[model samples]
Target: MAVTQVKVDATEARLAAIPAPDKGAAWIEAARDAARARLREMGLPGRRDEYWKFTRPDSLTAPEAPAAALFEMGEPQVFDGFDRVKLVFVDGVFDADSSDDPALAGVEIERLATAAQTDIHWARETYGILEARGQTPVPRPLAALNTACAGDGVLIRATARAEKPISLIYRHESKTSDAYLHHVIRVESGAELTLLENGPAAARFNKVMEVDIADGGRFNHVRAQGRDHERRAATHIFARLGAEAVFKSFTMTVNGQMTRNECVVEMAGDDAVAHVAGAAMGDGDFHDDDTVFVTHDAERCESRQVFKKVLRGGAVGVFQGKILVKAGAQKTDGYQISQSLLLDGDSQFLAKPELEIYADDVVCSHGSTTGAIDADTLYYLRSRGLPKAEATDLLVLSFLAEAVEEIEDDALRNEVTARLGAWLARRRG
Candidate 1:
């Protein structure tokens, strides 16, 4: 097939206008600068780019580069009011006074920039190396842009075992402007870490986070993407798992103007297991897209993924999940399923589940289904004297119960459920 080219002057111009580089590790700074240069040469993603086809980048054209600011935040509330080690960032700058994580035992929690300055070895090796090995050429623009101007977030290291969970909150307080945030999370060996990532887009925030899980480790990552009506944001996450390592990630996209989430999980060792699941509820003119890629490169690896999307009004939802097993990745077991419910005639959903396997001794299966709410079930509920809106809400909850049930944390589960219920009320009203 012949390759055609399209001009990407806008993307190039936007990248070219970023401010001068600051003092940091010469290598990481250089790597970021190089990526920007490459992006300029490659241009922005277009319809030809399969990964970004459904969610175009044309609408993201900005008149000027985003500025740095100290955004005003709303009344602060604990993420479920948990007594866990916590770190807070408002508009990408760390708030030392706002954070109150009781200095836990057997954990090394420090500011990312502080760690980058004092203990450069650990920070550079974890963030710099993993990103290089996992980055792709297609979505290079986003990563490059983040690298060039990555604000301070958190860098936590769990020494042996953590008695309590380690939580981080990225809050967007400024509603009148756009803010950029970049975060890095790493877990060492023989350690257990639970991360509750809360992205409440008050005004607007564009964020990129990179996480790495070491050998003999377990990481549970939960993300809540709930924002006001005027907010627009995107999150790009890349994670690598070592031998006998486990990663379980759950994401709930309940509200937003435009939200895009992409996760790449690479299983590079034996006996590694990765479970990815998410639920999305969109209303009005919302655009929600969740894309995930799981690659198995070693023997005896397993992965499972399930995503459920509920669409109402003129909302558009997209789900694309792909699993790839390499030639030598024998005994790889992969399973994927995506289901969607279109509540109204004007609403739409697109689900694409794909599998590419080169190993003959592997077991892989994928399935996708798109349908309306079961009329018989709805009638049965209405027959029981329940209002139409209540019946629909019950059915929507029932449809998404499979994914919601996996959340082990009680506080997070209840909070997510409440958010979903609130969305259903607005839709059925």
Candidate 2:
């Protein structure tokens, strides 16, 4: 592929920030080199790029993280009720002193920094493999940058059903901190595990997670990104599923100056299931984007893409989703929906929904809608003696119900709802 001069310069500028020395084991060093080459070839994203035309990449691609005021964390933390092992990161750096020992929870877990030092490790198979594959059809330069220069992360191997979930908590302390993190998760055959994430990591954050699920394995992920009203983040999740495996993930984004969340999945085994969903609420100076791609490469596979957004106070929201069914993938079931509830005329929503199919016997559908709250419902609630602000908050929750329902666990689902409600309440006039 021919490269542009502007892209080349930007890629080099970002690459220069990372140290030039090789500091990891042979495998990790090789992986990072490969990712560097890919990044060089693709270059940093620009507004002219097809996938990034809606949101500006200037703040995210700048040499340093833009300054952002820290929000107070006085409220109750999300997922505090779950009996899970916690891994903490402050300003994108791992906080070993404040984190729990990673040896618990029916899983073998290790930090990427430590695991990469070993000459032989299972992480070599996945560290940057999936992210590299996801680049095609669409170039994700930020993800490649993460693969090449991730400072800290985790490697989790689930051998059996975990008795407790594993939670990753991120905290922002500096006014201008930039962070990059990459995580790899492998669920062995017939195993089950739950992964939970919350908090805003830094002024600017770039993260990537690669998941590989073996036959009959199940992986569930629930994340909350919020409370920090002024922040920037670009995150990616790349997943591969084996026969009879299940992969489900949902993210709720509460606050950010700008955020882009991308998920790419490939179902290579028959009867595999993959579902990715998210709910985001944006206020003043906020811009959020959710981009997803799912490919069905085997027979009898199922996939879903559900996303909801609530925008107010001149906020902007964007969604780009696509599902592709391979030629021989018979009995494929693909569903996609992206909806936005615009609270005022000042806010905006942009969506690009697509479906490409090579199979004749597949069930695939996609729909996108942008609208305001139901006036009739609001009137009914107000007539029942509910305050106008409270009624609107109730309606906003109802609008986001579909995406939240994608969370399979009842307790976790309710916790997300409560967090979202609190955000709406705080923003209500």
Best by TM-score: 2
Per-candidate local distance difference test: 0.71, 0.91
lDDT of 1 by residue, 164-233 (tens): 7777776665533545556666777878778777755334455666677788788888787764554566
Q: Model 2: which residue pairs collide?
A: none
User: Per-prediction RMSD in angstroms?
Assistant: 3.2, 1.2
Poorest stretch of ten by lDDT in candidate 1: 65-74
| Residue lDDT tens for model 2, 196-273 | 998888888899999999999999999999778777999999999999999999999987899999999999999999
Against the hidden true structure, what lDDT does model 1 obtain?
Answer: 0.71
Candidate 2 structure lDDT: 0.91
Candidate 1, position 125, lDDT: 62
Off by over 4 Å in 1: 1-8, 16-21, 61-78, 201-204, 426-429
